[model samples]
Target: MSRLAGRRSAVDIVIGVVTHVTHHELFHDAARTLSGVDLEWVSYDHEDEIRDKVAEFLSTTRLDGFLAGPVPYTASQELLPPGLPVGVIRSSALDLTLALYRAQERGWGRTPVSIDTFPAEAVEAVATALDLDQDQIDCLPYAPSQSVDEIVAFHRDAFARFGERSYVISVRAAVRGQLSGQIPIMSGMPVPATIRTELHELALRIESDRASAQRFAAGVFLISDAPDEERARIALMNHLHNTPEFAGAWIENRGRRGVVVFAHKALFERITRNWVAVPALAEAAAALGARISAGFGVGVSARNCVLLAEQAAARAELAVEPCAYLFEDSGVVIGPMGPVGAALRYSYRSHGDDVERLAKYVGLSATTVSRLAALDQELQGRTLSPGELAGHLGITDQSGRRLIRTLDAGGLVSVEGTAQHHPKGRPTRLYRLRIAQALEAQPWSSPAATSSS
Candidate 1:
């Protein structure tokens, strides 16, 4: 039964089924038939051809995801594209039971056996079901680099130990071929239910991808003028058009002001998948000599999204570097999208009145106070040295010390520790920002005013 059958306009999810042989091809066809999902089978004779075959399928077909049938899990992982979700059909308990039942017909049940398949866990599960221990069966689990000769040797050794009573169960057809005449080799292939389960998993992943793409997130990019600014705009448009995998048709040309719409999913996926992706994108842009300010926004409507994106763009423009900013729906503003954004969001909860009072008391701007609070959060509420405060404020140590004195006097910060300076100099005191406490203190009183009086 199709999970999507009752929908108003049901989309037939296109999937690529990759397998090695004709038998597995039939198995996958049955799987697709049972699944009630569209499947395109791409078979390769040799394991090495899996990469090329999968590439061909992706280029020709609109595949939602891939099902690696009878394909080694390790090989499938190596062959398929990094972005595509891959599900593998491997030996299950049913496979082991069915193979054993078949062997029982040939008077081989309860006999000592050797098996070669993917993962030892599968064999162990089957063994547990039959109330047998690991020592009773000789099992050689397949890894990516294991050779056919090694498999043959393992089977030969098992046969030597148990003689005629020894039976061989192999998942690989190649192993079956080599040991056909010598042992009662039964195929321990994945059951129909396992195949269906994997296909269902693939369907879920595709649905998730579609839903994520449909989510409304806006990006307003500030593309700095090139020598031929129009040419640069054209170049960017062409670049977007050429890469449908990333940009798709989800881009709008706003001329020299650049595109108001850049796909946030692309950037979001990149960031989620790789921690260094934000920095990586910046470095890539730098290498291309592209001075771009990208701001991402997500909201209910296009108007709100654009406004939020504009705010994000304004934030991005503050830094002298090329970066991306995200305007989240929760009113949390973050980014320069790399290292700066990594620590920028903490304490940016924006208590404007509170920040203003603290800034006045500390003889600092609201912006400086906000930055200090954010830094305090990054420091995990630890006391900060004057040098650290100076770096955060982009000021000299003397200026930082003077500001700290004002804040200390105003009760916005309290001295936590002191480090004695060399020889004759005064001690350097460390202070922790008490912005939350200052915020609660109600009316602002200027430490600068109090000192003068």
Candidate 2:
């Protein structure tokens, strides 16, 4: 929400758009015109500055989502807030076809020509669609690894092979700039339909967030047992009051051993998304030498939700860690939160044939398996310490160490080194997640369940 957010009479959502290239004004105008929903758009100029621009926008104004080019979207994924929605604009087939038509209109299609804009497959697809023969086209493919000089050389070679009066088709700014004056070049920009579709998806995500924000939930904690130390109790209360997750919460003491805390439903659901808070709370209680268990309930009203959460928390205390359980208004109980402990013997629903196979092979929950796959790509075969792993998983350090041990037991990680005290006394141990190797391993009919037992 910006200063101009609710000012628009018809617009229901506010979003930000970042255009890296100058021509993005066309996309911004087109998406704004074609999209049926009333939207207030904030424009940003640089793609490389996505993180700074987005953070500033988020702080100053409220937005449902952000739109950017594919390069900016991919580069900013890890930097942006994980919960925030981002949409990427890409060039469509129609755009490529139109550019080729422009070249044809210039009478360049009549002679054998060379084109260098997209990759080989894309070039081939466009050539086929335009009914241009392979013999008449020397399609120079663009590889991401190629340097600007390499691309320039490629275009120069194509120009030499096809002779004068031919044209070079390039989408890259560098390639086009270099080929200018030396050769005739045509630009291919993304079409409005493609941009509108991406924007529509962003609007849908904003709607989803709005819907989720409206759903009310509450957490009820019952500290069934605790040490008789008054200092410990006071410390726990102070820490709870200071926690951002429990901000604006109301906490009450029931005797010396029991307590009740209430917070917004949205806060609890946000924790659930990252699988972080419940485990962090467990670790916190352990550090404070207090025995605590909590439950969360989602409903239309706060009072009923608290009562349900109390009941769910009572049930959770029977477990070892006493991780929070979620109780829906419809009477559904979800979990002992955090990563599902390896000791639990609960049946899991398979995501699909492929996911089920991967989960089974890795001896982890479907969610964990999916995250591990994503981490594999992010790490690029490099190792990460427990602290780094915690940062990656959005969990506390203790919880991250526990997860690493669980992963180790599942044969999904290789310990690369022993813990060494840093010059500053901080400890470090190198460990690599062996997800790729796990995929290559023989499929086990029954992989060890995600537990030490």
Candidate 3:
């Protein structure tokens, strides 16, 4: 049992593991070593049953984290709920090494072996460590599009070429089943150590997320141009008091025109549906017949939280229509939170002429370029596929593809690689936006150029 299991105050973490029936016992034995975790197994015997099984698991269980092998993850990626912590278990080099040792024990030498699903680098490293010839090894790295037949064919060809000397090592159970009778094969199942490490990491992530969600948050609601200040304030308070979502919140009046609320950050997130929309602001406006602006702040101290809320409320007041804004201690500003298309988020810091220059150079509007800049900052150097970018920008996939081409032409983005979220389609190209770098590279106006202008 882990230290977490010994803690009486520790909340039970439920983990859902999706895998083939063949590996159910293997995963169950591994999960037993994790004392505080409740493992819910969703096992499928065939590829076609994976999606329904995953959906059923999600609907039936409350999962703090999810785990699956690469094949199952790829098959059911689209079915998972957004923002859920997911861990994809890959066959480690250690697992591959064990499989090779097993083959050796069966009187098949490590040389002249065909392996599938393990990376080529891993194969080379193991073969080099074992003093095996690289030329005698045939490796087929895992691809999301790779089929069982293709793997079987690759191994069969290697065995045919190498005659009696060659054997196969496969990470996929289907491939082993396909080639079971005709060829010598070894299964490269992930060992318990690898599974345990992934589970521990996933549990830590879930705990961290829970802690962050429970942080203190403040919301300030202000009514502008109200005919009766006290009545409007009272009305706002009443509406919030009647709201089912705000039932747990602490609500009070801030000033003649403002109402304040205090609650866990998670409550606010639920009310706003994870910052996508705030229907309460719209509802308040319609009910009170006044222009209402709301600001939410999350900070280290209560005083700082209220100050930040006031600052965000001031920003909301400048907008032409009623809206809401969220200001965080980390300096992220998300708002004008109306409908989906109207909301925009960015850092509070000034962008100056760099955004304008980039926009003009790229033949896009300044606002679009600014949003892209904010998105680049939010990503923190992680690459995104066009489909994922579309989700972020609230646009169609085709539009995202077109925008990627435009950015590629303008030197604002570079293709990193391809990511196959699903098994059937072509892999989506991933790109990292270089908006900040592009802005820095723009030439400054010289004195002579200024004088000429």
Candidate 4:
């Protein structure tokens, strides 16, 4: 900061992490409060590239000073080329060292360490603030950064690993004086994402219980049966949002469809384990003929969060009686066979009834109608040969053909296509359920959707 002092200089700080914007903002405020040096920040999708670009600002450039906003883990070859005095400020080295100690203390030690730094302090701050010994404090050295190229790549890799979590492209501390800010950005990720796939797999292990959640995020679950369900949910939402333990949260009906409960993704594991759903919903389910279940998901972005919540909601059905199974993995994944599965089965059964309706129209026997329904259900709406239908219904294949032809004459079922078996033998006919008229009393609404399944 002293380097930028007293000179009419333009300082550019490029940063990678959105959460770290506040730290940079404070730095600028202090400059105005103290040195009065003007600094401009240009934000981008990834930080490593931004740092490399900032590093190049040194060549053939008449800039006053450069601050690497938490650059390449401090004091490395990436330290703004050492052509000018550059200070790369991280929030607190001592605090970080203590965090490392806490993690290591859990015996979670390993080589090539990584810190998310978001949840550590937010959780334990009030209970335990900056208490470390000299041996413990030494862990906070600027992490080794070999070159600007390697250092920037490291940060980008870290950001990439945080995939499917909520992230955005934003700019802050805009440059008032300029060289143009147009630069090509590259992100190799697929569009329309949810949680990082790896993270979701890990989340599977985390049951929605109390203690397990303490590891993921802060705050406790707010079950329904509170004086007012919506009011309680709103209060908890606001409360968690304000807390550092909050990454984000949602309100779910719990196992009870009618009631709402507030849950923090940070604490979902505990809640799941506890069989916690909104009690009000449980009460309402008894009143309604059908039951209700609910669950919630959490993380960095609203879209990913909704995906998570829906995943939880899907699982809640598994816990409840109607739908008793939920599967993990998003998009085109198979689900369990409880109530929702039963609902699907019932729909197919209802469609089979049209065979009876057609039987009445064609004046076929009760046995014939039952046989046709059985064959139709298995064929999945595809036309079946009378021989195949007869084989399916334990009748002689030729007899089945005669039966189908009689029905075809009445337009109950149709021989839509034919295939020649042998020039001498005969041509095989294909018959399927005719939809000339609507069947009565439909079941479970329309066709199954992959989204709900």
Candidate 5:
């Protein structure tokens, strides 16, 4: 069944497509068959303009996803915000074949041709299939570090080497300007079919993420040390009932000293700013003089969710401070969620002594390393900026940057790219946490490792 089959309302997805001016019509033609998606075009006449255009597009639009070819993506990759779904349209074999056919129509035979950006294997495969001489085909695969000048040089040198018998086929739009009149050139842009498929796939991914965020979740709030349990419970209930954030939630008393609230996980995410903090806990303590500890659970069934929430609440009670904890069906526990800077999260699942080993290797505490592991699991392969990581871990931005440096130095994180949140200043560096992989690679002298060996 389709993931979007039972959705209540049509999802309005906005996708930003960054392309050269020449390919704008191509992208639009490809998106004509798609529904429920509005494509905001960010077209650039030159590669130099891509970065500014992308930054302008992002600042003005609320895009659900982004798509660009390799050249534009590489040029402006560091400008894209984290967590925005991105699709990089590469030149497919079909695109290459079509370009070759067009070249043939123009009286430029397939042989004695120079191709750029397509993989050498793809070039070889197409050559073999068409019975063309592979020896006459010069190929240069795309690399992130390869510049426009370098690409132009490869074609120019190929033209010089092959003389008038050779023509150039390039996926890069920039090459057309450099070698247009100097040599016979054919554009190898991705065809509309390739773009259409990529657009559909990206739309489905956006919808899937939206649906997952809206899944039902339960939260259990307990008056752990109230002098008058009934009054404290009533106060907690009243506070939650009156809070605008909980207006959509079903808030009711669960026990003598507890109240349960049920709502979509997205609501909680908004209230907690993506589980960075639970201001309600502190608000209850300060405003109502009721020390409330919160436990939020997400599971398959309502009953099981409540049970997990209760368990999480008990865990929160173990803390000396008023805080909240999250217990997911996946056995990931994130807790001590008071102020953003004081919270710590760790998985309930055992990693044997890997956490300890990683901690030692990185010169950080086991608890911190474990928390990172839990965070990495929760992120599910999404890259985050240091500021976002800091917010999640409840630490200062500087501390977050320092932590990233530590993790990077210890080989536990990789630089994914940069993200520009605002229109000004330098972009923030994005990093993907590799704590789980690092922990898995940690050499442990435990019985589990020994027995497995």
Candidate 6:
């Protein structure tokens, strides 16, 4: 039933099966076009690969949630536990089961869909909307397990079928003022444009006889060359505002002249021109003051770009922005900025702690812990109850039927969701912990070491 979703799967993206295709194609598709990321179409078999595919998705892709078959709920217990939001597509048809299996095969973890029950009629609704063969959508449930190598194979195959080659320059914009926490694309991935010329030109004029990487590091000129910071600041801003992603922006005072700039930490070493992305952004910014220039820096990884961009933007503001007559000598750096990076960094750090805690308990590699931590943290939130606490701890509630059972079983803490009290009926019950809790291990009480799950 996921006709278009699978069709566009060659370009892997952060999405789930429950999302309606029309909306998915309109918005997310634009994001992929502007950002150059794509989803892939993975053809999966229902009976042979159902379980294996689901597990593979859990291990490899960032899953939103797993879809359960009409088979008994008891059989589906350990498949994806209650720690994460999950849905069960109620379908006895083998083909429909297969679509769920295919959709399940991508990420390490994802935001679970609230539609836990996908009845046959509901599946039919999707089938009608997607113009898919209802019979084929019937047979898609069942599987065993997939190897780690297979997961890698999935990425490789998808890339081989739809990979690009170029010196990549990425300009990231937060969507709807929110961080989606989508996986950064694989390294060595090519972007749609190049930046060597702009960067090379800036390097030639910086006066310092040092290497280009060092000379252009600051995106600034000597006081002797530009005189005062204000003149330099204004001159730089005029030019940077022309580049892509700065659309509808204006220069604002920091301590000095130019505006701030940030890009992938990698861009400090290479300047990639995104001529393709300029027009739309320019229009968006046209109504605003429309002046921006960046001070650039080089970092070994994207994380470093956050701090570097802040430092560079601050310097750029003081250095003076260019106007009317100049090439693309934008004074701004290409990287993520400060203030803009607060939330992203915090989430990354918190997620890191989750990995460390889980790593000690499971004895998995640091990489696996890191990957799984992302899934765990993204799937959890404000809800806190006895079962949730236990599930969050990844411990089994083996004690008894009571809430304390979570503690005895292995649950470290508990969490709960909204529930209504039963006046004269049986006790009201909400979702329970399907995951086990943390076992006694190292502690996370200080800066040197921390623990969380």
Give the root-mean-square deviation of each candidate in angstroms: 22.3, 16.1, 13.6, 29.8, 14.4, 22.1
Q: Which rank order by lDDT, best down to worst?
A: 5, 3, 1, 2, 4, 6
Local accuracy of candidate 4 as per-residue lDDT tens digits, 1-453: 123233553332221111124344443444443232334343333434454544454443443333343232222223333222223223332334444455455554311232321122222221234443222111111222223333334334543554422121111111101111321111211111111221121122222122333422211232333455555555444443544423444433323223233444334433332222233233333433234444343444445544554564555454435332212222111122332223211112223334433333333433345445544556667887877767776766755754564444343465566778788976665667653232332211233100110
In order, the Cα lDDT scores of the candidates are 0.62, 0.59, 0.76, 0.35, 0.77, 0.30
- Name model 1 segments beyond 4 Å from true: 1-10, 25-29, 32-36, 48-52, 55-59, 70-79, 220-291, 297-321, 325-453
TM per candidate: 0.53, 0.53, 0.70, 0.20, 0.66, 0.26
Q: Poorest 10 consecutive residues of model 2 by lDDT?
A: 343-352
Q: In candidate 5, what are the lDDT values of residues 1-453, reduced to their tens digit?
A: 011112323467888888788887798789889887777778788877877778877787777888887667666655666346667677767889999999999998887999998865457658866899887889987655677888899998898888897999998877888899999999998899988977887788689769867888999999966679998888889988989999999999999999999988889877876665888888777766767888999888888889989998888888888888888776656666884527454444543445644564444545567678878988999999989999988877866865675576456898887788889876766889998887677633333222200
Please tell me which model should have the higher TM-score, number 4 or number 5.
Answer: 5
Q: Write the per-residue lDDT of candidate 6 for residues 253-367, one digit (tens) a residue.
A: 4446444444332233223231111122233234233444343434444334334545544443453332110011222212222212211111122232243343322222233
TM-score (C-alpha, index-matched) for candidate 2: 0.53
Preferred candidate (TM-score higher): 2 or 3: 3
Q: Which residue window of length 10 is worst by lDDT in model 4?
A: 170-179
Q: For model 6, what is the C-alpha lDDT against the true structure?
A: 0.30
Candidate 2: RMSD over Cα atoms?
A: 16.1
Q: Which stretches of candidate 3 lie over 4 Å from their true place?
A: 1-10, 127-132, 225-231, 254-256, 307-321, 330-336, 339-453
Listed per model in order, the count of residue pairs whose N, CA or C atoms clash below 3 Å is 0, 4, 0, 26, 2, 101
By lDDT, the better pick of 2 and 4 is: 2
Lowest lDDT 10-mer window, candidate 5? 1-10
- lDDT agreement of model 4 with the native: 0.35
Minimal lDDT window, size 10, model 6: 166-175
Candidate 5 vs. true structure, TM-score: 0.66
Q: Please list all clashing residue pairs in model 2, or write none if there are none.
A: 1-62, 217-265, 342-450, 342-451
